[model samples]
Target chain A: MSVLLSATRISKRFGGVQALSDVEFSIRRGEIYGLIGPNGAGKTTLFNVLTSVYAADDGRFEFDGAPLSGLKPHQVAARGIARTFQNIRLFANLTAIENVMIGRHVRTRAGVFGAMLRTRATRAEEAAIEARAAALLDYVGLAARADDLARQLPYGEQRRLEIARALATEPLLLALDEPAAGMNATETSDLRRLIERIRGDGITVLLIEHDMKLVMGLSDRVLVLDYGRRIAEGPPAQVRTDPKVIEAYLGTGATSATRAHAEPAPAGARPGAVPGAAN
Target chain B: MNRAARPRSPLAALGVILVAAALLVLPFALAQAGTAWVRITNLAILFALLALGLNIVVGFAGLLDLGYIAFYGVGAYVWAMLASPHFNLHLPFWAILPIGALAACVFGVLLGAPTLKLRGDYLAIVTLGFGEIVRIFLNNLSRPVNITNGPQGIARIDPVRIGEFDFSTTSKIAGLTFSGPIKYYYLLLVFLVVVIVLNMRLQDSRIGRAWEAIREDEIAARAMGIDTTSVKLLAFAMGASFGGIAGGMFASMQSFISPESFVLVESVMVLAMVVLGGMGNIWGVVLGAVLLTFVPEILRYTVEPLQKAAFGRTIVEPEVIRMLLFGLALVLMMLFRPSGILPSSARRREREGRQP
Candidate 1:
C-alpha cells in the first residue's frame, strides 16, 4: 500500500508542559492504523497537530507526499483530511442531512450570485451535493434519519451521524477519535465491520481507540505511546506481548490513578473481560 | 420518516397574496382617510424596508451592528448631493439611487473588511463608533461649502425621474399626472415588495446557510472550508445596500436631508423592529417595523384628545406617552420573548430541544 500520511518526529508544547515529543506516526493507504495510549498521553494532541487545530512546535506532516505546513484546519480539510471530534461537535440546530451537506462546502462551487439567481449550474451542483450527502448518510446507516435535527438523535446514532458528516467531505484519510466508544458489544462489532468496509473503499483510517479488542483485532499495525512519547510499535501480536506495552498500560500514571481510587479487578483480569474469557 | 420531513407551509404563499393585496389597496384606503395618514403609511413602509435590511446583519448573521443607520444616512446624503438644488447638480433619482446603493456597499466593505474578525460586543462598539464618526464628518463638512450644507442641511431635493416621466407634480405619465402621497406610496410599496422577495430568496440560499453556520458555531463553520470573513462581509454589504436604497427613497419623498435624521435612536428603532418581529425572519421584521412606526401616530390622535377632555388640563402629552409606552413595550417583550415573536424555525427547534 502507498503511504497516505506520515508524521515525522512531531513535538508540541503548551507553555512549559510538553504535550507530544518526538512522536513518529504514519498510515498507509487503505490501512487501519490504531493509536493507543492512556489518557493525557498526547493522542489527541497529535490529532490536533495533524489537523492543524494546534500547530506543532517541531517536526512536519505530509499527506499524499505533499508537505503540510502553516495550513489552517479548513485548509487541511480542503486538502482531503477529515476528522470527527472525540466529543461530538455538530451544529445542533441543523438537520442531520444538512450537517453532512455542510461538509460538502469545499466541493460545491456555487457562489452568492449563482445561488441568488438559481443558475442551472448551481442547481445541478446543489442536487449533486445532496445526493452525495445522502449516500454518505446511508453508508453510516443514517439515511432514515437524514432530515431529523442532529441533537434529537439517540447517542449512538449521533456518533454515527458525525462519521457520516465527515465522510461527506470525501476524504482520502479519515481520522476517527473513537468509533467504538460508548457502544455495546453488538454495536462495536457492527462498527468494526463498517470501518473495515470504509477501508475497503481505499481510504486510510487513523483511529484513536481505548477498546483493546478493536485496537488489536482490526488494526493492521498499532502504535503505542506513554507520557507523550512513543513506547512501542508493531502488529497486534508483537505489540501485545511487548513488555513496554504492558508496563505503559498497567504501570502508567493513568492506570495507577484509576486503580488507586477504584476497586481493583483480580490479578490476570484483562480489560475487556467478557463472561467466559478465562477459558 | 423524519419529523422535519414535513413540507414547508403554504403560509409563505398566503403571506405573499395578503401582502400584495394590502400594498395595492392600503394607500387608496388611507387616501380616503386623509392625505397626512397616507403619507405616514409611506414613511412607515420606508422604515420597514430599512429595518429588514438591518435585520440581515444584526438578526441573521448574529452581528450587532450599531452603525447600521450610517448606510441609510449615506444613501440619503448621496441622493441629496447628486440631485438637490443645494448642490445644483440635479441627476435623475433613478440614477442616484443605484449610485447610492453602490456607495453604501463600498462603505460597507470598507467598514466590514477591517472589523469582520472582531466578534460579538467588540463589533457592536466598533460599528457604533463608525456611525458617530460618519455623522460628525457630515455635520462638519462645510469647509467644502458647495457639497454638504452643514447643520443647515440640504433641501429641494428633486423627485425621481424615469425617461421623461418625472415623479414631480408638473410631470405627466400615460395621460395622467403623478402627484402627492399616493404616487410615492405606490412607488415605495413596489420597492418594499422587491426587497422582501429578494430577502426571502436570500434566506434559502447557500450564503444564508453559511451565515447561519457562522452564527451557530464559527469553528465548525470554518472547519467545513467556508471563508467566514468573506461570508460575513457579504451579509453586511448586502444588508447595507438595502438601507441605501431606502435612504435614497426617503430623500426624494421628503425633499430634505439632514445628519440628525440618522442618529443613534434611528439605529435602535430599526433594531427594535427586528427584535419585536423576529431576527432571521424577514416578514416578522417587516411586521415589527409597521406596527412600531404607526402605533405612535394612532396614539397621538387618542391620547391628546382624551387628556384635554378629561382633566381640564393635559394629563400627558401624546408624544411623551407614546415614547414611554414604546420603551416599556420593548423592555417587556425582551423580558418575555428574548427570541422575539416569530423566531426562526431552526432557532425555535434548537431552543425547544434544549429543554430537559
Candidate 2:
C-alpha cells in the first residue's frame, strides 16, 4: 500500500540529446508498474538513473524511504534493487545456474581466502548458494538446463534465465527492461504468470515492455513517457483513455480524428486492441 | 559434490600414483644432461605457477594484466632482501614467504585500484607500464639507496632450508643422490601442485563465479549487485599473490635475484602460456607452461644441428628461427582454435557458438 520507489524530476542528457526530462512517478509496493512509450521514450534512461547506472543530470530517487541518488549500480543492487538488461545480458559463458549464483553474490559472505580454503562456513554458504541458484532456475522453468551454458540456451529461454538471475539477488524491487521483448506468445504468457507470481511473493516490479498486451495484463498501474517526459500515469484503463498518451503513440493527425470519436472509442476493452496503443 | 569424490575414485587414484611416480623419476631420467634438464623442469613449474596466477586475472576475471611479473619480482626481491646476506637478515623461509605474498598482494591492490576503470587493451597497456616501472625501479634503485644492486643483480641469496636440511646442497638418501636441482624439482613440484589446486578451487567458487560473470559482462555483473571494482581488485590481488609466492620460490631456488628475469617478455611468456594452454583451464595452463619451456630447448638442441648437417652452414640465426617458429605456431593456433588448446568447458561452448 506504501510507495516502494519514487523519482522526482529525474533528467538525463547525452551530449546533444536530452534522453530524459522531468520524468516522475512512484511505484507502490507489491505492484507491477508498467512503463510504455513510443521508441526512445527514455524509459531505459529512467531505469538507469534509478539503478545509478548513470548519474542523473537532475533530481533524485528514494527507495524504501532512503535516498537512492548517486549510488553505484552494485550499491543500488545491494540496497535490494536488481535489474535485467533489455537485450538479455546474461553472463553468456557461464552456466545457467552460475549466472544465477552471481546474482546471489551481494547476499553471500565468502571471500577469496574463504573460497580458496573452503572452510566449514564457506562450504556451507556455497552449498546454500548453489541450492538457491538451482531453485531459481526451476522457478524460471529452466531447471533441466541448469548446467547448460547461457549462450547456448534459446533466445526466449535466455530472457527467462536473465529473470531467474535477477531474482537470485533477493531484490525487493526487480526492474526488468524489455523482459518480454523477444518472447513468443507462450513465453509471454509464462512471463506474465512469472511476474504475477513475483508480485504474489510481495516484491515490487518495474517493467519496461513494448509488448502492450503483457504490460496491460500484468501492470496494476501504468506510466507513459514521450520523448523524455511523463505524459500520463494511472490505472491502465484510465491511462489508455488519456489523449496525451494517444497523441504520443499515434501522432498529431490520428489524435484529432480519434478525439472526435471519443465516445465511440469504447475506452478500448482490450488496450492492446486499440490501434493507437501498438507501442 | 562429486568433485570432492573425484580424486578418490580407483581409476583417478591410479592415475595420481602413476603421475607421482613419473614426476619422481623425471629429474633422474633427464639427469643425463647434468642437471640442465632438471633445471629446465624446475623453471617450467615456476612458469606454470606464473601462468596459473595470470589466469586468475586474464582468464577468469577477463582482465588482461601484462605487468603480472612485477608481483613475481616483488616476491623474489622481498625474499632476497629479507633472507639474503646483503641485508644481514636471515629470516626463515616460512616467515619470508608470507611476507612476500602479502607484500605482493598489497602491490596488486595498489595497481588494481588505479587501473580498475580500464579494460581490455587499455588495461593491458597500463599493466605493461606497471611491469616496466617495477623493472626500472629494480634496475635503478642501486643509486642513493644502493638497493637491488642495480644491473649487476643480487647473488648468493639463501636457498630454501627447513630446520637442519639445506636444499642448496646435494644429499644422498636411500642410495639416491639428490642434487640441488633435483631437490629443487621436488620443491617446485609441490609449489606447482599447491598453485594448480588453488586455481582449480578458485575456478569453481563463488568468487570465481563472480569473476567469470564480470569477464562475461561487467555491466550485467554490476546490475546483479556485484561490486565490480572490488571483485576486479580481488582478481588482481589473487593473481599477484600467486606470482609473489612463485617469485620467492624462484629467488630461493636459483639463489639469485635479477631485474632481467622479470621483463615484459617474461610477462608475455606467462600470458602466452595461459592463452596457449587454455585461458581458464588449470591443466591447460600447466601444459602450456611446460610446452613453452621445453619447446625452445627442443629447438635449440635439434634445429641448429640439423641445419648444419643438411646445409653445411646455417641459413639463419637459430634464435630468430626459434622465435619465428614459435610465432608461427601461435598464429596457426589462433586461426584454428581461438580459445586455446585446452579451453575451459564454458569457453569451449562459447567457441562452438562463435564459429557456428
Candidate 3:
C-alpha cells in the first residue's frame, strides 16, 4: 500500500523537558494505524506535531508527499488531515449538524460579499453543505439529533458527533486523539466498528488510544511508545508480546517480567477487556 | 426529520411586516408632535446600525472590541473631510458615504491584524487603547495644518440629496410636506433595513458559521480548516463597515463632526446594546439599541418631573438616576438572564430546559 503520511525524526520540546524525540511513523493508505503509549508518553504530542498544533523542533513530515513544515493547524486541515481532540471539543452551543457543517469550511468558498448578497451560487453551496452535513450526521447515527445542541447529547453520542464532525472535513487521513477514551464496553465496541468502517471507506486512520483492547482489536498495525520513545512497532499480537511494552505498562521488576510472559496468548481476542487498561 | 416545526415563523413574519409598516408611517404620524422626537428616532436607528456592526465582532466572532466607536469616528471623519465646508469640499452624499465605510474597514483591518492574537481581556484593553488613540489623534490633528479643526470640530457638513430633493430641506411629495427630520428618518430607515438584511444573511451563511465556530473553539475551528486569522479580521472589517456607514449618516444629519462625539462611553453604550439585546441575534441587538436609547429618554420625562414635584427641586438628577438604573439593570440581567432579552438561537437552545 502507498504511504499516506510519513514522519521522520519528529521532535518537540516544552521549555526544558522533551515532549517528543525522534518519533517516526508512517500510515499506509486505508490502514488503521494505532499509536499506543503510557500516560505522558508523547502519543498526543506526536498527534499534535502531525496535525501542526505544535511545530516539530527537529524534523519534517509529509502528507500525500507534500512537506508539512511550517503549516498552521488550519493549513494542515486544508491539506485533508482532520483530527478530534483528546477531550471532546464540539461547538457545544451549536447544533450537531451545525458543528459538522463547520468542518466543510475549507471546501466552501462563499465569502462576506456572497453571503451578504445571497448570490445564487452561495445558496446552492449552502444547500450542498447542509446535505453533506446531514449525511455525515446520519452516518454517525445522529440524524435524529441533528438539530439538538451538541451539549444536549449524551457522552457517547458527543464522542460520535466529534468523529462525525472530523469525517465531515472529507479527510484523506483521520487522526483521532482518543476515540474510546471514556467509553463504556458497548460504546467502545461501537467505536471499534466505526473505526473499522472508516477504514472501509478508504480513509487512513491514525489513532492514539489508551484502550489496549480497542487498539489491538481494531488496528492493522500498532506502534508502542514509552517515555517519549518507541518501544515496539509491529502487528498487535507481536507488539502485545513485546517485553518492553509490558515493562513500560506494568513497570520494571521481576513481577512485571513474569506477568509479561504469563499473560494468555488470546487476551486481545476479547473486544472489551478494560477501559483505559494501559493507562 | 424529527426537528420541531418552528410554529412562530409565520407569526414572526407578520410581526415584522407590521413593525415595518408602522416604522414607514411613524415620522408622518409624529409630524404634529414636533421634529425633536423624529430626530431622536433617527438617532436611535443610527445607533441600531452601529450596534449591529458591533454585534458582528462581539457576538458572532466572540471578540471583545471595546473601542468599536473608533470606526464610527473614522467614518464620521471621512465624511467630515469629504463633504464638509471646513475644507471647501462638498462631495455628494452617496459618493462620500462609501469612502467613509472603506476607510473604517481599512482601519479595522489595521487594528485587527495586530490584536487578533490577543484573546479576551487583553483584546478588550488593546481595543480600548486604540479607541482612545483615535479620539486623541482626531482631537489633536487640528494643530499646525488644522486638519480636524482641533476641539472646535468640523461644521457645515453636506446633507444627503437625491436629484433635486435635498434631505436638509423640507419638500412636498405625494401631496404631503416632508420635513428635514422626516426625510432623514426615511433615509436612515432604508439604511437600517439594508443593514438588518445583511446581518441576517451573514448569521446564516458559511462565513457566519465559521465565525461562530471560532467563537466556540478556536483550536477546533482551525482543526476544521477555518482560517481564523482572516475570518477574525473579516469580522472586524465587516463590523466596522456598518459603524462607518452609520457614522456618515450621523455626520450628515447633525451637520457637524467632533472628536467628543466618539467617546469611550459611546463604545461602551453600543457594546451594552449588543449584550443587553442578545449578542448574535440581529433583531435582538436592534431591540437593545432602541430600548437603551428610549428608556433613558422615557426616564428623563417621567423621573425628573417626579423628582421636581416630590423634592421641590431637581436634587436627584435624571441623568444620574438613568445611569444608576442602567448599571443595576445590567447587573440583574447578568445574574438572571446572562444571555440577554432575545438570546441567539444557539444560546436559547443551550439555556432551555436548564435549572435557573
Could you give me the TM-score of model 1 versus the true structure?
A: 0.88
Once fitted onto the true fold, the runs of candidate 2 whose alpha carbons sit more than 4 angstroms away are A259-279, B5-9, B346-356
Per-prediction TM-score: 0.88, 0.95, 0.94
Name the lDDT value of residue B294 in candidate 2. 92
Report, for every candidate in turn, its global Cα lDDT versus the true structure.
0.80, 0.87, 0.87
Which ranges of candidate 1 are over 4 A from the true structure? A184-187, A252-279, B1-18, B144-146, B168-179, B309-312, B346-356
* Tens digit of per-residue lDDT, candidate 1, span B216-330: 7777776676678888999889989999999999999888888999898898888888889988878788888998889988998888878878887777877799999988989
- Scoring each candidate complex against the real one, what DockQ results? 0.37, 0.59, 0.58
lDDT tens digits by residue: candidate 3, B185-221: 9999899999988988888889999999999999999
Chain B TM-score, structure 2: 0.95
Writing each residue's lDDT as its tens digit, candidate 3 over A1-279 gives 999999898888999879888988888999999998777788889988888888899988988989989999999998989999989999998989899999988988999999888888988888889899999999888888887889999999999999999998889999998888778999988888888889999999998887767888888999887778888888888887677766666555423444535432221212233323523
Estimate, for each residue in B1-356, the C-alpha lDDT of model 2 and write its tens digit: 21452335588679999999999899999898768888999999999988999999998999999999999999999999999887888999999999999999999999999998999899999999999999999999999988889988888899999998889899999999999999989889988888877787788788898899899999999998888999999999999999999999999998988899999999999999999998888888899999999999889888888989999988888898899999999999899988889888854454334331
Q: Model 1 residue B212 lDDT?
A: 77
Candidate 3: lDDT of B226?
Answer: 94
Fraction of native contacts, model 2: 0.80
